[model samples]
Target chain A: MAGTDHDKPLITGGPAIILVEPQLGENIGMVARAMANFGLSELRLINPRDGWPSEKARAAASKADHVIDGAVVFDTLEEAVADLNFIYATTARERDGFKPVRGPEEASRRLRTRNDAGERTGILFGRERFGLSNEEVAMADEIVTFPVNPAFASLNIAQAVLLMSYEWMKSGFGAEQTPFAGPDVMPASKEHLNGMIGHLESALDARGYFRPAAKKPKMLDNLRAVLTRPAFTLEEIKLLRGIISSLDYFSPKTPRGSGNPERKAKVDRDRHGKSGETVKDEER
Target chain B: MAGTDHDKPLITGGPAIILVEPQLGENIGMVARAMANFGLSELRLINPRDGWPSEKARAAASKADHVIDGAVVFDTLEEAVADLNFIYATTARERDGFKPVRGPEEASRRLRTRNDAGERTGILFGRERFGLSNEEVAMADEIVTFPVNPAFASLNIAQAVLLMSYEWMKSGFGAEQTPFAGPDVMPASKEHLNGMIGHLESALDARGYFRPAAKKPKMLDNLRAVLTRPAFTLEEIKLLRGIISSLDYFSPKTPRGSGNPERKAKVDRDRHGKSGETVKDEER
Candidate 1:
């Protein structure tokens, strides 16, 4: 009864973690700890490196043995995720698919809501050695990745699950208030983005991006998907469009291409006047 | 005369940044700033926010004024890229194309080789407002992307430029080298990787990972990529894989989905196990 919709906890309430082909008992243990840290207790392991009830994992779990004991092990991602209504695949590499990929925070946010809805949701984490395969990613409705230092993007197994869980919990547990102040308050609503899209379409059409008549609709959808993925709130959108309109008025491109050539070739070097580093060097 | 490579004594001489239809002057300025910080100065704007030579952009460029002022505007990416022999396009969304895609570091690595050959190369970043159109991405040889937070995949134009520039500079300069020891030796070689991979693969084979027959190749590739991406030195990789193997032998995933569900969860609170914060009750 406690696991029922309204009675369930916010962040950990919905999704289960399905680790496919994990190779290390320690990583399993660490992952369990991370999961517990993020409030998620339901775990499913498919082909773990060490067998379950691992002493090594038990030794490493810290306070998360509860999560480990509760974790389920399976043989494949498909069977692991079959029980869930919404499935998210976690990966470190780009996969071939049409799935909407989001970072950990976004994934958590979406998953948190599903929990509130009482939907059985799960996140599939691939093996510690590799990650989820393309086929595996295709099975999920979404893909979750993390923004890490590009110079060093090899996040540990436990780190990945932990970071995602952190964000999901923070975003979904009525923790919208932040420690650091962001630019604005509200997330861009769908209607607000639609207005922005209309403006952008007009601008594109004027520039002939709609080119052939038959391609217009498809182009619009593509443009919309790319531009409006995470909608920008009204202020941000308005400010951006304002900047675009101003630039168009001043240095607009041609009908088929962007505006003037002379203006385009200039390195906008006027920022620091003639004093910036070597201004003349930039002036070809 | 200006288009000549000699015209600009490029800070670190990596790749030029060409931004198309970037909607925010602040963002363009920021991109310039991002480039400048990483010793990248060539900034090309196809179309920008707030007009060329925008004072607002200059002011916002922070320390990137040198990059902002030297920025070149282009009517199209083609015109902007005319001087470069190789090109890479950056997009947040997946482009429907067959072009080989590379992460930012790899993109820079290729460009560094071309640069060493004295071949002019440039990296193109799409507008923050709409990103590069699929057509634009198609015109390029490779797609450059960041391993970013999936939920907040959008990088400010400058942020994206900075990320690529950082990778390009890091590689071109060969920063320290992987397993970078201050006064000690650099990392191991490709030969070392082969041996290590062979060893690990054999170890994994012994564990029954080659199961299902169809999954072997993908699993191997996935493991190889994860281990090699950060290019771990002999010690690092050895330490990592060693830990993994040790854990595997201890406890593996339960053979079936649920292995004795009634079993009591074990507890281990090792100090090495970093269970820093509790994720459960932070409802705020």
Candidate 2:
């Protein structure tokens, strides 16, 4: 999980995450890792508890070295956020009600829009125990709070960062495109499905799975309905056919092609010996 | 951050968080805390690496004691998820693409829908070092992955839990209502704004701020536009009038009432002696 892909571009540049008097180096490191996870790189520290060049922070960042290495420290919060045009103060406590309150999603959207418009924006996070003071909250353009369980609303510094960073990433990049695409196999063709169904019916007929002869067609219809409902892919149909073949004829106790030698030979050829072109030709 | 409100009902039940062979008691504790922050209380463990009842986990959970106390342990992933009607496997690495894949938002929405329908659902997370194996992922109904930076895709166990829990909370409850409401101050009345503007203009006139008599109206118009644009609150207008009064005539070096005694008295009374009713009467 700590591995970093140097070959891929290290996506940087988002709202600066300004930590105002963060207490622990480990927390700071974790914050950097969270920020990096969501493509944020700018980190500004306002009077860190332990002075700059913290080994604990470096170690905790896991491989988000760029975020830590590029971190800028300021003596005061004012200086830390001096260059940013828009600022959001993150707090759990209620303030004197001068500023507008926003939830994380709205705040992230605003930040992303402003960032896109070429305005620098930042989100201010407070100390570990007590959050941003009334005065600090007043400095920001607006207030942003997470919709946490009101009773247990206090999120750890890093958890807060992870949440906001996630929203920021989602707002900017969207959540539709996963990092990697899923399997591209097509759904089973009706013809392919019918072939599998016919083969399975023959196997079941040999085993007398359709109990009463009068109920055989109804039982076959039920089996087909169950099998067709899943919309099995070509690969799945092939696997199901293999399973049926193994159950009916592949057991060592029974010789492989003892029953219906010609059909068994055809199934065997399709299963193990047919090439992609031959399979397509047979499908045609 | 560690405080919990015992008086309030503890929010229990969401998608069960199934950790498969999770290592580190601290991570388990952090995961529990994250879950508590978002109101998810169900925690199911499938063979935790170190034995259960870990003090480290309890300490790490901050005040999310209920989550830790209610955690259930199972011998296998199948046993852990036996009762759940739907399951989502969280993975940072790519799989062979058998199951459908979803981003966190989509996954959370699906889980919320299922949970609301009275179906038991769970999210599966894997070991800290390596994520859910292909086999473990295959056991779930679908795969859920974070939309993270492709270069730094890996997220530590707790961070991953925090992200998904946040999404779950947002999906169910929405992110519109912040925990606390903002200030309820109304916009200043036009009469109130004009009074402050006129008072400041008189002060400027007394000090010859409008250099030429011919341009005084234009100067007054510019000043009015600048002051009116902010749409200051009633309190803000009152504060501004006080500032104008202080700057024009309240210096200790000069007598308080020497410039304009009647106006001085009105300003002083409004600044320090008026009650809410008195202010309303004046506005009327």
lDDT of 2 by residue, B40-77 (tens): 99999988999898899999998788899999999987
DockQ of predicted model 2: 0.15
lDDT of 2 at B34: 93
Chain A vs. true chain A, TM-score per model, equals: 0.57, 0.86
Instruction: State each model's TM-score restricted to chain B.
Output: 0.57, 0.60
Query: Each candidate's TM vs. the true structure?
Result: 0.33, 0.74
Give the poorly placed runs of model 1, Cα more than 4 Å off. A1-284, B1-10, B175-284
Per-prediction DockQ scores?
A: 0.01, 0.15
| Tens-digit per-residue lDDT, A109-207, candidate 2 | 999999989999999999997878888888999998887887777598998898899888888865356776666646778887787777656554443
